[model samples]
Target chain A: MAVIDIRIDLKKGVADPEGNNTKKTLESLGFKGVTDVKAVKVFEISLDMPAGEAKKCGEDMCVKLLANPVIHNFSVTVR
Target chain B: MKPEEIRVCVLRIEGTNCEDEMADAFRMAGAQAEKVHLKQLTGETFPEMKRNLEDYDILALPGGFAAGDYVRAGAIFAARIKSALGRDVKKFVEDGKPVLGVCNGFQVLVELGLLPALDGTMSPVPTAALYTNDSGRFECRPTVVRNDNGGRCIFTSSVERGKLMMIPSAHAEGRLMSRDLDFIRKLEENDQVVFRYVRDDGGKAEYPWNPNGSESDIAGICNPAGNVMGMMPHPERVVTRFTHPDWTRNCPGGEGDGLQIFRSVVDRLG
Candidate 1:
């Protein structure tokens, strides 16, 4: 009944150390498949197995609680 | 001589990271300023908090991560400012009061529909100000920007047509976009388009320097009344001489480029 989506920004001035470190580690492992990997903000969400309110609630969470309104951004959908 | 000591208001919110620098810059520019948390303002809705609007000559929204850039950049701030804070901003503009939005603040303006159209007329909902940077990422750099709107904006009066100034921008979604082409052309003809990012050669509007792929390589703009201004760059962050990205080579230019905006508003109070 519910599907939610959230996006997180890489912190301002954050050199994206995770991405650089990943590339280095991959190269040392002799993995050629990894070229670039940027760390992004993630919303680890658990939703109702099925329902409309999940989508609705996700939006509420962003506007009031999860979202800081000063920096981070988000969005929502139901499936 | 000090321009009647204009009183200005600088707002600091949880994600709003620029008020402190903006306040210091305003002080350096010789204006009386009060930086307050919107939480401390005692209001159920945004309009109620506006009690302070009449008390200050200019209202400034500084750049910083607000609401942690949730729901798209500046969306939470937009929502807060729109239904709650928007009515008050509307009143402020009607009275010819001055307002400035920088970086995240610029996003908030667009989200709230207050920026591109404060021409003192029209707006069931003001349809301008702030947009995605089209770059799909954040850009932080120093570059030359040309002022397109002359003395119309209180903060830009000192700017000469074709004058070049420097400011740094940091944002992921800073591109300017509008669906209406006619609207864009009219804004250009009216000289409402204020700031455009230019090449280092300073001859044309080019990429990287412009950062965001805005409609006309636009970096910033003001309303028709010229009282409300918005831009993606951070003027406050570079107010200090040492804040320049290239400080080792140059002494930060005179009080800093951002300070001029504060002074221009105080001058209006005089």
Candidate 2:
């Protein structure tokens, strides 16, 4: 079985309200030099297939439902 | 068909909390309306509960977090619909039947690729999305929306062109965004934009007046054919005058601004 992990985040130009608020909280805690923050949704999929095939399926999942291409970007990693 | 002959289906699933009000709105407009579970349409429910999409003259997707809005708002519900009754939905639209979605329902329509179906009955993938609000918090407030569809949108046919209507909006993720460069031009050219957020006097809106900062101050849109529409405001909530946020103060009297939407679509059937 192959374990695939997909991480989806708002595209570069899209605003991240939750992530930005988190950054604001961190700065209020006296953390310095926080330029930007990004919040992402991760999905861990267990595929009973070869690593290559698992990766392909993960990409398809992202395109179909896991991530919205209009506002998000996604990456798949197989382990 | 006559208005009384129209069968309106207010579709719902787990977490779809607004079906009752939506169905009531249609019934108030003098149609035969019922709330049907998604399972019923997908054949997962009892045989007696099964419903065919072709049986309904109007389909209404009401507001609420369908499937809990996980994996992106409306993603799960849209996926289930695509897999279960995609063909039926496509045919319904192809036949020019009216479909309305409000608030979270609007999110579902975008996820389902039904609104602004610029090139066809439904896009293979979502061409747009309702992103989280710029305020980073859920907004529940009274808003003004103007009919700009110029009589193209069937749902807004009764509403006068450029007339402002008071509609209450409540949502966390209501900012509509798209990657299409010609989105505004296409919407204008195709007469797909049905409603736009505006000030009480019909002036351009900004910030809270514009609510979630949706692109072009858009609050609602229709498919190119104008049979399908999705809006962020809850018109059902205002079918009566008492439901208005400032009904007592404004005292508009009798029916609410939103009743026209329901009456307009029902009138189409007649």
Candidate 3:
């Protein structure tokens, strides 16, 4: 199994408006259970390499293309 | 002093990598290299480093994702420098000492208002900018840099004329921007522009080698004092020949791409 994961920040300019809209809609629907929620996504990937080297290769993946780094942060673990 | 006795102290923090590599590079070049953490640069640690900085000839800012790019890359750390190590750095540079910043290190220097040139002297405010790439992407590639402006500076001495160093650059805000043509002209005229991205044939930073589309094809810049240098590329990562990724096909396995950078500093200190 090959698993490659990437995480990206939803900039405040773009993320907050949607989050606020959802809160309003949920409140109208009487689903007030969710509050102060921030949405973030994580991707998990498994590669062909052995576990010992997967973390090392994962870092290489980040260095190459996975993370933009300017606005996002990432962490990787091989299982 | 013997070359082996020469010391290099590398500043470090949580997200900074390449501290080990920096130590290794100096060690490989016959210098005593040590990684000193960021906390040690604080006022509380000032008493210890005041005398220590004089003992170690080279002060290097190794590359990494310092503070995980929180609240802007290098912004917080730059503030720490201003509040913590500001006076020491001021004295360090004013005394004509050598300091280097790579990748994130470059970011920190710019944040500290060190890279910007104003009125032919150091800017009292930030004049240099390293923003996101115009293409909206992080670039990773081998860049060929020309040392057109790196004249007698400690890091550029060993790089021969028309020499091309292949180094990896992994950063989003590597684009360089400034408005002082007088300063730019002075640098170009004085051979102080230091390193610029170029094609593999050493054709100036354009297109592929300068993947980020940095302004004027610039890959690196040194301060007017020539004691402070900052660049976006990762020279520490490419210090070995096999690390070139195509040893059998093209790499000739010579001095490794970044040895000259370290060697030049050692030569200067000695």
TM-score of each: 0.73, 0.98, 0.72
- Interface RMSD (Å), every candidate: 9.2, 0.6, 12.1
Task: Give the candidate order by descending DockQ.
Answer: 2, 1, 3
Scoring each candidate complex against the real one, what DockQ results?
A: 0.07, 0.89, 0.02
Summarize candidate 1's per-residue lDDT along B57-170 as a digit string, tens digits.
778887888888865566676666655556776787778877888888887766666667534433443354344454445677886678788667777777668876678877
User: Candidate 2, DockQ to 2 decimals?
Assistant: 0.89
lDDT per residue as tens, model 2, B1-270:
888899998999889998988998898899999899988888897898899889999999989989898998889999999998999999999899999999988998999999778898899889999989999999999999999997789999888898888999999999988999889889999999999999888899998988899999999999999999999998898889888877888846677888899999999778
> Among these predicted structures, which one has the highest TM-score?
2
How much is A37 displaced in model 2, in angstroms? 1.0
Candidate 3: CAPRI quality band? incorrect
How much is B61 displaced in model 2, in angstroms?
0.6
Per-residue error (Å), model 2, residue B79: 0.3
Write out the backbone clash pairs for model 3. Answer: A2-A46, A3-A45, A3-A46, A4-A45, B149-B191, B149-B193, B149-B194, B197-B205, B198-B204
Give the poorly placed runs of model 1, Cα more than 4 Å off.
A1-79, B1-4, B44-51, B118-132, B246-253
User: What C-alpha lDDT, on a 0 to 100 scale, does residue B171 get in candidate 2?
Assistant: 95
Where is the poorest 10-residue window by lDDT in model 2 chain B? B248-257
lDDT of 2 by residue, A2-26 (tens): 9999999888889889999999999
What do the candidate models score in CA lDDT, each in turn? 0.69, 0.91, 0.70
DockQ of 3: 0.02
